[model samples]
Target: MSQAKDQEMSMPSSRQESDRTAAPSNTKSLTLNSTRSGVGTGNFGGYGMTNGAEKPSVLHMIMEALGLRNQAQNREPTSKDIGTLIMLGVMFLLFVISVTGFFVMWFTEYYNNTMLENLILAENSDTAKSWLNPDPKYDTLLKAHIFDYPNIDDYLAGRADKIKVVDIGPLTYQEHTVKDEVSFNKNFTVSFRDRKSYKFLPEKSSIGEDYVVRVPNVPLISAAGPVKRMKPLERLFVSPWIKQFQEPLFKELTVSEYLWGYEDKIIKLKSLGRGRRRFGLLMSRNGTSVDSVQLNTGEDDITKFSIITQFNGMPQLDYWEGDECNRIDGSEPSMFSPHLLQDRSTVNVFLQVLCRKVPLHFEKESSLQKSSEPVLLSEHGTVLAQRSDQRHQVLRGCAHFSLVPALLHWRSGAVQRL
Candidate 1:
């Protein structure tokens, strides 16, 4: 009985030891599972609570700490975009400047042209003829003074007495013609004057014989004194506009020829009884052409001779003046009219006639006082008449010639006249 009771006690102790060991293992496993579950819950709460007032997720916190959120939200500009903006601003500014410059230039040119035109118009308006001849003192023509030489006998007697004597008899006269043609590249001025005079006829005259002879340079020498004294006229007439561009405007005149008529007879004396008998005889044809282009008269060919004279003069041509006056429309002088005469020497005679297109402001009139309003004389807007209306009778039946080359060029856009 005692042995059996001890065996039972041993078995119970072994069972109790086993149960204790199992309990520790199970408890450790339970603790590990609870810790893992708590970690998982914390992770889920962090991610889901981003929009709420909770701690940020790991990704959000990392981005915020590095300033990546701000970097992404406000991007830095690229070099291309920055360059494009600068270029656009510069281009816009340049466009504005260019537009402004063009307008400034256009206006400046327009203003200058307008001012020049006005000045030309004003000049034309000031020289009306009615204003120039108000006083009668300006109307009278000036007469030439005459001088006489010693007779042939007195001169011969003086020479025989050892006194120096010059023969003034048997004077022969000759005539010549001068034709001058002028051209201008720009506006120019010209002025000229000429005359023809005659002396008394001898006792006997033959048909077709000139009662008066022609003389060359006689009047020029008598009027101008000497060649040295006449040099100014030569220079003024030859190249009147050489240095004219320096001036704002210029004027000039040219005389193509002058005519005169004198006796064609030569006196002869024969020594008889200490006294001489004087006789006059005809030499050449009596009616010879003077400084004029001769023309035939219809029925009066015996006693009448016709002559044609041409006189051209211009003044006050302004170069800077633009083509507002339609001056470039045709090639011709706009203001002055030139007359063509058969004999310039015979003031009362008319053989052939010519007229110039002269501006009316420069004309002299007997009706106008020394001062008057401007005289406007234009047939069309294009045709300008000479200022001297009384001196020049406007021949409505006359022919016209286009002579200005510069005006032709302006109209054609070519340098050469058409």
Candidate 2:
């Protein structure tokens, strides 16, 4: 036992002194060796000279470790070495192919994008054609329901018999809109004057032109507004004309005479810039454009597509005392940006006639049978008109005017943008 113990002690201490230094035989070992060599580039390198000896590349060293290469003079290769060489050659070819494939994919996408950008909004492009002549399928029918007072005699005489009122038949009209003097601006906007002429749809109407309903005297009430604001001398000078007008508090006429045009004694005196002396409810505002609109073309930003950037070269109007009420917001009724609908729940709209701007709150989501996408139904609740018993509400202390309630529907799916 003692002899065995002596032999173990004199065995050259295999734990420390007898331990042999190892040479790299794989990628991991080679990487570690290169890191310790201090001449390697980055974390795993073979780029610089160390101790006056050139270091081979990671690929070369790997081949040597695999017994497929010789650093010194070449020897007759074995079958195993030939197999390894073939494998290494295949790996190198695969690497080259991978790099080439990635580069080709990137280049193809870039080229396609460039082509798409150049083709956008060209004179012959689909976008320009659609803008010039909108699709008939997208046209929305505009119909109105006029509220009539059946017991105006009792209501005016302070008789509160529930203030009986009824809604008349649907008045159907076709909009023939024309956008003229279109100018493509350099600032990625298009300026154009918009006007809309109406075509009465007698066939679609439930009530004919001869149908009459008793309602408030629109012209007399309109004249009374100016009379209240006039000075005493101005009122006195206008008193004779007012007496000659002979327009009573209420007047009876057919639907055609009220809506189209009717001769009036006072119309000629008030129309300084008007072409016709006759007056109608809808005739004066039809196809009338006193301003231009600047719309974004979505050339640079897709979110601003078809949005009204400016109206009459101004972002807001001076017609109202409320800042929020006068500010112009939202896109055209036909077109809106797909990106904008992602996170928004409420939609804003610019109304030309009644209220300038209003919020359309979301009500519910529904799917149409013809469309694959779901749409959100929104509406402007009668928060203004419902507050008082008066038929008309003052516009931010500006003037007394009535508003027609309307609803808006928008699709949730990604709409194709220009």
**Least well predicted 10-residue stretch by lDDT in candidate 1:** 248-257
Please report how far candidate 1 places residue 184 from its true position, in Å: 28
- Clashes (backbone N, CA, C under 3 Å), per candidate, total 40, 0
The whole-model lDDT of each prediction reads 0.31, 0.63
Superposed Cα deviation of residue 381, candidate 1 (Å): 26
What tens digits encode model 1's per-residue C-alpha lDDT throughout 40-154?
A: 2343442432233456445444454545444334334446545665676699999999999999999998986564343231212332222211233323221221112223234
Candidate 2 lDDT, 1-418, residue by residue in tens = 9999998998876655434433224656877787776745342243334455545656566666875676563345567766778888899999999999999999998986675454344344676667666665554455756556566566457563334556666878777666678888787888887676666788888787777767556666667667868999999998787778677665666677777667765677787547667867765446645667777777887656667778777887766655765777666665565544555656666655543655666656666667655457466664334444432334542221333222112234312221
Ten contiguous residues minimizing lDDT sum, candidate 2: 406-415
lDDT of 1 at 399: 23
Model 2 residue 93 CA deviation (Å) reads: 23
RMSD of each: 29.7, 20.4
Judged by whole-model lDDT over C-alpha atoms, candidate 2 comes out at 0.63
| Candidate 1 segments whose C-alpha is farther than 4 A from its true place | 1-77, 123-418
